[model samples]
Every structure is written in C-alpha cells, then in structure tokens.
Target: MQVNLPTNLLRSFVAIADTGSIVRATDKIFLTQSALSLQMKRLSEIVQVPLFRREQGTLVLTVSGERLLDLARRILELNDQAVESLDSVGLNGPVRIGIVQDFGDEILSGVLARFIQLNPGAELQIRVGHSREIRELFATHLIDIAVYHSVERDEFTVAPARMVWLGDPRLADRETLPLAFMTKPCLARDCAIAALEGAGRPYQLIVETSNISALRVAVEAGLALTCRSSAFTGHRLPAVELESLSLPTYFIAVMTLPSAHAAITGLAALITEAIENIVSPPFDLATDCPIKETEDA
Candidate 1:
C-alpha cells in the first residue's frame, strides 16, 4: 500500500527517536505530549510498521525506526541546505572587505573560511592595513566593509575593540617604563600615549616602528612596551608581561559609502556575526591581561 507522511509527523518521529522518551521528545518538538503521541501514531499507521518499541519504562527505536531515523536526518539537513542556498543567491556577487592586521591572522581567517563555504560563488576581495588606511578605504567606497580598532571619528557606528599591552617581564619592577610604539597616527598608539600622559606617569619613547610585526618583536626583546588588540594575544615568543589596559572599548563598526551598493549591508552582517562568534566567551572571547596601574608602565 502507498503511504503518505506529513512533514510534522516525520519531524515528530525523528524527535522521538533521537530523544528516546515521549516527554523529552515533546519538549524537543515544542508539542504537547498527547499531540506528539498522536503524530507518532499517525506516522506508524502510514508506514505500516512500529517505529518504536517499549523496553521496560523507556522507548527504544525499532529496526524500522532506526532506518527512518537516517532518512529523517538527511531530510532535515537538506532542508537547511535549501534555505542556505536560497539565502546565498543575492550574496553571490563580489564583496570588498578591509581588515586590520591585528585580527587578520586570528579572528578574520576563520570567518572568511566559513563565509566562503556558505557562499561558494561569492567573490571576496580583502585588503589588510592599519586602521587609518582601512577607514579611508571605506570612506572612499574602495571597500564595502572595514573592521578596525576604535577611533574618534564622526562617521561610522562604534563596535567593541580589544586592547592589550605587551612588555618584558623584567621591566615589571622598573622605576620608569620605556615604551615602543607604532606611528603616532595609529589608534592604539595614541591611546597608549594618552593613557600614560593622563596618569602623569613618566615614560620614555625609546623606539618607534611603523611595522606591527617589528614592533611586536621589539616589545618581546624588552626594547619597549607596545599596545595591541587582544586578538593578537596568541604570541608564542618569550615570556613577556601582558597587561590588559583600560583603554576605551574598541568597536568594530560597519562603514559604507553614501549610496553604497545594497549588498554591502548583508556582507557586513555576515562578517559581524562571524566576529561575534569568534570573540565572545568560553571561547576566550576576550583575553585576560593585567592593566597598567598608572598607564606609564
């Protein structure tokens, strides 16, 4: 006999098989116990087989139920794939993204990987630079979205930024701290200087470097203290003293040109979701580093 099963009934059956208890399955499917039972009954009637058999007080999937469970999982997975496929149609075009070097190696790599998997046909053009250069690119419509450190700008909404201080442990007890910094124009460098100045702490600017990697090396060599976002905290260099400074919260805001392409917003949303997933919690969403007591160190 030919049998037809409703989608809800199939879903209920899957839930029951997976959960192994009527009460628990009801919770999983968000249906009343009686309602779930009725659906299960209808499924068995249509299939002309017992999907589950009771063993003592618990329900176990029968041989037929096990076969159906495999089909159910495949069906659900296909349903999800279908939805994602539809969502990706508008996202198939090119999207230009600008990201700072700090997060480029750590957080953005995973996000880009997942985005490509989800939208295989989508074209991505990424540019990496310091925050100011990235911000300028966004303003000029050269890029669709830009992620960077927090800065004082009239344009763009603010998102949270991670900040950290790196220095040599030997300097922990130094009377006066020496600092190595990026160009004065850099956001993190400015914040580090301002924090020290505001705290009335005396610090010597011993070394200045325009390159982030070189500056990191300088800090590791105990040449000077350097500040960076928490995203760059995965250094395996020597034992450097890591201080979590209480700088202004950095925000990764979305920026688009006036009359920008409509697809930019959607792309920004995708990027933002990826960042949130990578940075937030038990994930070590944020790093724990000691704050500079007087900002001078």
Candidate 2:
C-alpha cells in the first residue's frame, strides 16, 4: 500500500517547526497543543521515523523532520496558491515597497512573481537598499511599504534573524580583523563594528561601499569579513560563529505608512506572509551552526 502525506499534518508540522514550539504553533494554526501533537504523531507514523527532538525547551527538527519541512512548505504553498488564485481580486494603484538587499533576491523572486500573478499589470515599484536606507525611504514616504532587518522591533516584526560573520575561515581567526561593510548607516555594518570593538578586537576597515554585492565579493575574496544574516550565506561562504562574532538576534520587519490605502495595506500583508515563510523556519536549520557552551560543560 502506498502511504500518503496529508496536508493537515504537514501544515501543523510546519507550524511547529516555524514557531519552535507546538504551544506557539497552536496560536498560528488555531489548534490545541494536544491536537497538534496528535497530528505530529500521525505524520511520524506515516513517515515511519521520529520527526522532532526537543532542545532547550524549544522544538528542533530531526533530520527526517527537516527533510519533510521543505516538501511540506511547498505542498502547502501550492495548496494556498491554488486557493488564493481562484479568488484573488487584483488590487488597483501602484504600490511602492523597499526591501533590504540581504533579503532582496530570495524574497523578491517569490514575492514579486506572486504579486504580479495575483494582480497582473499592477503598478508595483520596488527599491532595494540597506536596512537603514530602506527605513529612511519609509520615513520620507518614498515607499509605502518597507521590509528590512532591524535590531529593535519598532515595527511589525515578521521573523527573527540569525546574524553570522561570513568570510574565509582562515581569515576569521586572525588577531586583527579586516572588515568590509556597506557604508555608514547600515545595520549589519554597524553591528559588526560594534561587536568587534566591544570585544576589544583590533580591526581595520579595509573597504566600505553602499553595495552588499561588493562587500560580499570582498568577503568571498578573503579580503575582509562582514556580518550578515545566515538566511543567505550558507552555501556560498563559510559562516563564522565565534564569541566575538556572536551578536544578538535581529528581526525582519515590515513597516507601512499610516496614510497608506487599503491596497498598500493588502500588499504589506502579502509581504509579511512572504517574510514569515522564508525566515520563520530558517533559523537553526543547520547543525554545524553556532551553538552556545552547554551549561553542564
């Protein structure tokens, strides 16, 4: 007999994985903890493998669970997309949005295409810049909606960011650091400098530019190290998680203007969902990633 995966079970599993807790996941999926647990049990029974292992009171996905997460997300996304497309009333008026560059490519690929699909020929203006630049644009009303990473949750935060230092592993252990960052007024740059200086690590600002691509190129060439969220860096570069590189959790946020119209608000909601899907489950997705000293160690 061929076993089938149920959408309901996958949805609950994703909710638990994304939120890091079945208790919190309950609020998202509107199911009680017991019901969600039962669904997880059923899912594991079908898969015939244990799906979750708890860590520090938070649920971490097992290898089998991680394997299921990507497929589950795709399944639910297709299911939701099919449903939404059937009733998606295209919005009117141009919507201007600003997204920070770190998340630009990953986010825009899906969001822009989906928006266009839902609202064909809808006038959509988008700007990509550093987080600080995006915030400034939002403040000046240059953009109706903004998606950026920030240290503080002054706006609508969608997901937590796992900031890591990306560079050649050989260079990361040097005494004096070589740093290249997006010019002043950048969140990642600011955090990197602060963390290094706070740790009393000698450093040189080897290069400075307004382009994230330029900085990443510099980092990839092993010219200098820069701070970036783990969301985008894993495959291309070595991520260093040293004590000095250790930084606080940041958040990807969506901010909207108070004067925005309903269409802009609706677009903001769309952006919010997109961000959540990307990063809600991105954290701790890797094991060789940063881990703190065990209390018992």
Clashes of each: 8, 0
Q: What is the alpha-carbon lDDT for the whole of candidate 2?
A: 0.76
lDDT of 2 by residue, 179-265 (tens): 887876777777777888789888888889887778768888889888877655534775776664577778788889886655567
Runs of candidate 2 with Cα error greater than 4 angstroms are: 1-88, 232-235, 258-263, 280-297
Clashing pairs in 1: 159-251, 159-252, 160-250, 160-251, 161-250, 161-251, 244-290, 279-285
What range of 10 consecutive residues in model 1 has the weakest lDDT sum? Answer: 281-290
TM-scores, all models, native as reference: 0.53, 0.60
What does the lDDT read for residue 23 in candidate 1?
96
lDDT of model 2 at position 76? 83
Report the number of the highest-lDDT candidate.
Answer: 2
What pairs collide in candidate 2?
none
Go through the candidates in order and give each one's C-alpha lDDT. 0.67, 0.76
